[model samples]
Target: MPIAPKHLKFDDGSVTIIGVDCATQSSKVGLALGSMSKGLLTIDKAMKVGKSGSIANVVSSWIRENSTTKTLIAMDSPLGWPIKLGEELIGHTAGSSLSTEAHQMFRRRTDFFIKEQANKQSLDVGADRIARTAHAALRLIDEIKEQVGMSIPLAWNSELRHPISVIEVYPAVTLKSCRLLSATSYKKESNGAREQIVDGLSEFMTLPEADKQSIIDDDDILDAVACVLAGSHFINNESVGPATTEDSALAEKEGWIWARMPR
Candidate 1:
């Protein structure tokens, strides 16, 4: 028998969505503003955060500007490290043998789950350059919380009505789920792949012609828009979450990547 669909009960009329394609350097970080109202999603703006030296300032300014609307910040970066890596490193010496295997220590449960469901594996935060991006993401969250004067928690439920909430998103998995271009393909020199991706995305959200061209010109901008679509899947209760209690427990510490199931 087929399984029944599960959905989060979100009843709000409208909400602002910000998709952040985070990077270690502020110049490479991309930000996109979007909105969902009465079941329609629209992309309002997209741009690089610029060489402002601080991504928090740009994001905080946007938040302050849209203070009246509930906002969801979907970031394209890991928010936490592997739970096993943290647990196994406690009180360890330089030459001590680790209890957990290297693969398990480097990957979180959510990483494995995404691979199993979407066939798209996220980078290992414990042993990759992406670790720096992950650190930046966490620090950015803390800085934003301090600047905004609000508790910006990692949202687990779609119906979370907090004034400001954040969630980790993987644009690659989202693109795969939507049958668009692969993440690496669109970042190449040619803009053909990106144009195709924008065309595919237009079926779901309203994208201005100028913004669509901007997204095609920059991979970071495209990923930021994809992040918004992933967040939309979460809000519409189409994205997968932790299925087991142990998965949930690990996700609480290691963070979860919000994306739709494989097509």
Candidate 2:
């Protein structure tokens, strides 16, 4: 609930975008790196985190290798624990007396805002709904910190405006915003749902017809691609959601989710 920051611009041809969807199952974690050149996005690297060894090591290495080049990472995980949840998890004195209503009201401002904009509900990071993902994400953050020496969890993407930046992204909202698929329908493995989602994303992103099959088969990959697309907008200064003042305390403590951009 803070005033948004000024748009941060990047040199069009120099930015490399990374997208990641973190999951408890290493195999389900998606990773992709790409760049826009001449109006076309070329996915230069794509893989499942499990296959690449430590997700932290792999991603941090890639980021460091590209540190000299403008880069923006769009991650599909809660980068920071919600303010209320953090207290609850650690048994802070302030949250000891919080009631259910108080807990509900204390959800991250960005989470509610993004849900409203995307017309879909996101699991509250403070609740059990996303405990596993949050845990995994926190581990990944730790790994990045140890390996890349970056404080991704607490870094301010807007103010940094550095060669390497990070933002949280939600794939379902991204897909829905692109009008490619309903967020719920395509994520499952049943009834060719996965294939449908893949095909739709391939078509929508204008990926090469011959190359579509390879990247589209995995839901993780699709989400990663969507994350990269979101990062693309981010570098272009077209992203949504950033709290600078209104709930400054909570905003800084619970990093915001930067969702879909206008077409």
Candidate 3:
């Protein structure tokens, strides 16, 4: 894998990355915090948000606690909808005929790009239950921004000097990039499958026994950890980005999913 050109350089050790497996309900969301130093990734904390907790509150608290470290938040949810869908819906009537293709209207350019690059398809944010999750994720980001008093923009590269930054990630695609996908379903109640995944992940980062056990016990926690891995790839410039000028324009509106490409 080639390292993409960096727009700005900074110490990897100074940055703190958080992976959030976002969901509509706080109880289903997973959060993890880690940092990379000397090419080794260390996970300091990982947990579910619990029924009474709030994602924004937890994240803002972390920002306040770690005031000096740059924070990169990688969330597992679509941050934007298709550009065509929004354009076509402006004057769309109940009985009007739509000109755009269904897939183009529902899916963003980044969605198709992920399918081609990672051989995985993300759910259509314009036409799926995932849309609700996306809405919740964006709302949570806004709340965090309000609380932290910073413009937490979606980062395009690793130059994160801001107090906070965000990126979209897909854990399934991250798993595929790492060749960790197995015939056995890890998302099910099978600890054996989850254990296999944690074992495979050891090749990329060192996981404490407790963190490994927590990840194996819950698929959400595993995904949150995977999101952290994706964040690592992004911060290191190992993840793929916009391929063309047009694609870059579309990504600003439709949002991009930063994941490590399969080797």
Model number with the top TM-score: 3
Give me the overall lDDT of model 3. Answer: 0.87
The candidate, 1 or 2, that scores higher on lDDT is 1
Which predicted model would earn the best lDDT? Answer: 3
Please tell me which model should have the higher TM-score, number 1 or number 3: 3
- Candidate 2 residue spans exceeding 4 A from truth: 1-12, 38-40, 86-97, 100-106, 149-160, 190-211, 261-263
* Candidate 1 lDDT score at position 191: 89
Residue range 44-81, candidate 1, lDDT tens digits: 88888678667787778777766656789999998988
Return whichever of 1 and 2 wins on TM-score.
Answer: 1
TM-score (C-alpha) between model 1 and the true structure:
0.92
How well does candidate 2 score on lDDT at residue 193? 62
Error of 1 at 251 (Å): 0.9
The clash number for model 1 is 0
Model 3 misplaced stretches (Cα beyond 4 Å): 1-12
Ranking by lDDT: 3, 1, 2
> Taking the tens digit of each residue's C-alpha lDDT, what string does model 2 give over 1-263?
11112333445456677788888877788888777655566666767856546887777777666654556777888866666665555655653665446545446778777766666677777667476887897787677767765455343543445545677888877776667665356666653665666666655445544545546667787788888877765555555756457755666777777766434
Sorting all predicted structures by TM-score, with the top scorer first, yields: 3, 1, 2
Question: Over the full model, what C-alpha lDDT does candidate 1 score relative to the true structure?
Answer: 0.85
